[model samples]
Target: MTRDITIVGAGWAGLAAAVKATQLGLKVHLFDAANAPGGRAKSVAHQGQLFDNGQHALIGAYSETLGLIQTMDLQPQALFERQAMKWQYPRGECYALPQDAYPLKALRSLLFSKRFSVREKSTLLKPLFFSVSQALWGKTDDTVAHLFQGVSPKIMRDIISPLCLSALNTPVSVASANIFMRVLKDAFANPPQSCEFLFPRLPLSDIFPLPCLNWLRERGARIQLNHRIDDLQDLDPHVPAILAVPPWQASLLTHDKYPQWSMLAKHIKHRAIASIYVKGLRAESDSKQAPSSSYPGSLMCLNDHDESEDCVHPQFGLQRDVNASTRNSHPEGAEHWALIVSAADPNARQTIIENALKAACEQLKLSDVQLELCTVEKRATFSCDAHLQRPPCWIDSGLMAAGDYVQGPYPGTLEGAVRSGFQAVTQLVDASFVSSHAGNTSRVL
Candidate 1:
């Protein structure tokens, strides 16, 4: 059980740490509670179809993620679709968010698209104008909303808010300006092609974790699945263990040799994501039409007027049954479509899913859609709330923590998780080198 490095959790962060540690010639033991890898990003099977737990998309600016993908040598195109994305809204209204999916094509669409008023389009340019300056020099106390409020009418409510909420998983009003600026810099400052948004064509686990697993195995890293750490013990003085387990789990382990670091533990919050997958009998009539295509899934916020209180599931995008086009009718007489709704609060999920299903039906014009199978998944992940209790990247001597909960500008995102792992590995490698050098110098003296 003695390992130079022991990584808990086989999610992207843990996997990333293993990959990097193995590269540094360090022996790593990777452990996870899941039977397989990919944590939240994994896939699930239902009846005959394979569906992802949620829809995940990455932008060209995700250099680190893309680099990891390359390192695994997985065909990016096989798993992901790197192309221009369509920003859809109600009334069948759609606009192309400016990036390299097709820069010239998007520009032409923006100029003529009726998605915004001419005045709003002019306002949209406000971000482009200030994006460079902000990116280069960095932003101030200006929150994303504050900085872009008056720039463009369309930009504020439509573009900025939606984009910010989607990326940060928080409302635009409170989303950080620095993080928002980093997004702008990645898009506008980097090559247009580099900004191409990437969405996995396959399930997320296939896209996120499987590749890392294969890569780690080839690199000689040991992966332990279904092996949850019950407790941490025997931390001899000056020996530190990375407590990368969940905060709740960490609290249970507080009686261990090291409880002082557990103070940063209370700041962590548990957030739940509830997803309802509905499979219904497809009508024989619609069999000629394509089954799955996403609409810009939109829901009206309930409470906040500034759209702050409304639990607008920006990521609540849609998935229509692609099988509808080919088959005249479901053999089982069930129409199929996947509705995924995630929220921090479980009580609110019921309302969110009911309203979302209604909106999805109206948008897809499938009012007669009957639910054959409705499955709900709760306890999706920990909340990545702003100002939460987050510990530093490096904790005690020879020990470190890396997960979505660690110090980062963003919340519990794949990017945040991976970044934490990357940073943790960096600290571990650097510290080890320094330790070795110091010991050698002392012996010589």
Candidate 2:
């Protein structure tokens, strides 16, 4: 009889595991409390328009996520619009990487960037050299602030700090330096395209989650939605199970079975992400106001530390034409703008949205913006602080766990979640194969 594998949680990690396990010819059973999948990365429809729980950015370096997308038979070109790395701030400062070659384009972009002073540009080399060397040897396991001890304050404010907040969802003062360095290594050390940004043309759910769910269902996998598994022991012990829920949920489910892992999961703090959607902004009719032909999309990084206090409102901003896609069925003449606030406060969500919209309008030279929708994910991602003790995938011989919070080189990201899923599934498959082989060998003896 084929070995049956039960998976708890229908998020990216769990879905990825289910797909891989199914491919391996295992009977797969997946469960989640939510009616639909995607977990924190999911999308919702409000007033006939679709929006993600939080605005997420993807880079070419996200190999695992990209691979999973391909494996699901989704064309990357159709799902995302790829562009070279471009960081446009509200203060008329832009830093765009060239599309030519690896180190050459990277160096050229840094040197030509108007955001950095000549002295600061020259100083940037030291950190780059150090990071490259450390990538080969090893990075210091400390706060990201300490990692760039002698770097210019300008570089830190403009580059490192934003990158840290966006990637790790933790402030640079406390984020893990090791993970930050690894991210940098992956971005610059690889091919130039690896540094390119991938903006989803569709809602994030359409990009991965819903498609993955359909793929699994069509393959004869049993999925139980809105079915919360309160106890792991309730399930049949003969079938191995993978718990791919959030860190907090995982803690609750594993407390009785694996107290140590539960403690670790409970200890893991979480960071919040708030996306404030605004509408009624004027589209750029003037050629001067429009982005270059190379960058047709509206993507901007908010100048969160300008002389004006209001400028430091949103961490990042994205503007999408509502009529661009027929999938969301957005009303005509309506535009959607999302301001991503990292480490957001739940109580002050309305105030945050208002401030963010004001800042965004001021920067984009638009007036009369209207607040359309505001969404906040309080436990969007686990805090990736220095020395953060994340729970491992293998909780016990018969049970495993998978999520972005699972101990990995990456922080809380789609890639991290998918990679963790693959890792957990591999562990389960390997153990099962080993056991079966051992049993056969013993019988032969």
Candidate 3:
């Protein structure tokens, strides 16, 4: 098929590129090896219920992602259950405020909350102060551990370690300061409400993937599912193309042509995420209590620290059954625990899940919790470590790269993926304009 542009990999990035190209009046053809779209953000069907492969939260600061969803005509408020930004621990140290509150409001909450002592709070805020200051005058590129050695248990348990683990998907000792600062800067740049957690009301696929694919197909963009492109010659070479797959797949596809780019992408280390779903079954005697209000919040920061290296509890805990209190998904009057462990060891999934289920039940005060299912995306995100060099989006004149792993300030997030996809389409158009102008100049000469 003759298309103005072809998008490889129909995950968020590829779907995003196809959407933008269609908006720009380009003939777009999109393909993916998977049966469905969404890549790492896809949903899984188990026992007739849809659960996300992993917990993919949409922060208020995700302007590009939010805008893209709006363009698809999906109501943000309808699709997502919005809650104020809150940093909470299992033992209940909370830095929180209403939606769109200034970033300073979080600090205010911290100062007012009795969970951490003055010295302990100071310890937590000190590194943040340095990161903000570094964002201004100087360049600070180091690991989290180096930036704050002798990291006290109080401060670590309070917020820093868990936040870094969730944000970077890398251990604080090895995570990159550059990427960390970029996340902070992006957060501070957006509207105060941008930091609110936009937890999707529906399954992950219903959120963006299916809606987007429907939109594209409703238009004229060709959508090919379970189709793989083996070579560059297999695609429409006359048109520009965007390789929007994950770094591993991107590396494999480009190894024959762009060797250096391929190598850089191939060498990018990845972190894994485990989605451990447990059913919170209250005994029939406790059925009188409100099942919907059983959990304190939709999500909370978990203290996954155990002296034993074998016991790595989940870093985050969310209540999947209570997606929207108004909707009340748990008609059976049972709670479903959605626990997430970022930077998980693929081999030790069973250990992590076992520890996390027990710990989370105690922390959240669940009556009876039984393991439902546990799924892990081994290559969930890139290991955003110090001195990491990501590949560029613009690969060549006719080919471009589009994914979260590309050169960007943000970490591997949906926002990063969407931004890269939009940028890839822009690059394609810009390159064509430049080439046409060059030909015209030569003709005149």
TM-score of each: 0.76, 0.91, 0.89
Tens-place lDDT per residue, model 3, 236-349, is: 667678999898888888899899989988999988888888777656664443222333336766664632121257877777644442243554756777788888886788
Instruction: Tell me which residue pairs clash in candidate 2.
Output: 304-312
Per-model tally of clashing residue pairs: 15, 1, 4
Tell me which of candidates 2 and 3 scores higher on TM-score. 2
Top model by lDDT, which number?
A: 2
Per-residue C-alpha lDDT of model 2 across residues 1-445, encoded as one tens digit per residue: 2367899998889988888787766778999999999988888887777877777778899998998989889999888888778888766668888766547676788888877789887877766677678768875588887777778887887777778888888888788988987786687767666888888878889899999999998989999999999998777788888999999999998898789999999999887778887765456573367333333345677755632111225777777544543265645555567787776665677688778778756765555678878887878888899988888999998689999999899999998999999888788767662122222211110
As a TM-score, model 1 comes out at 0.76
The numbered model that scores best in TM-score is 2
Q: What would you estimate as the lDDT of candidate 1?
A: 0.58
lDDT of each: 0.58, 0.78, 0.75
- Superposed by TM-score, candidate 2 places the C-alpha of residue 251 at a distance from the truth, in angstroms, of 0.4
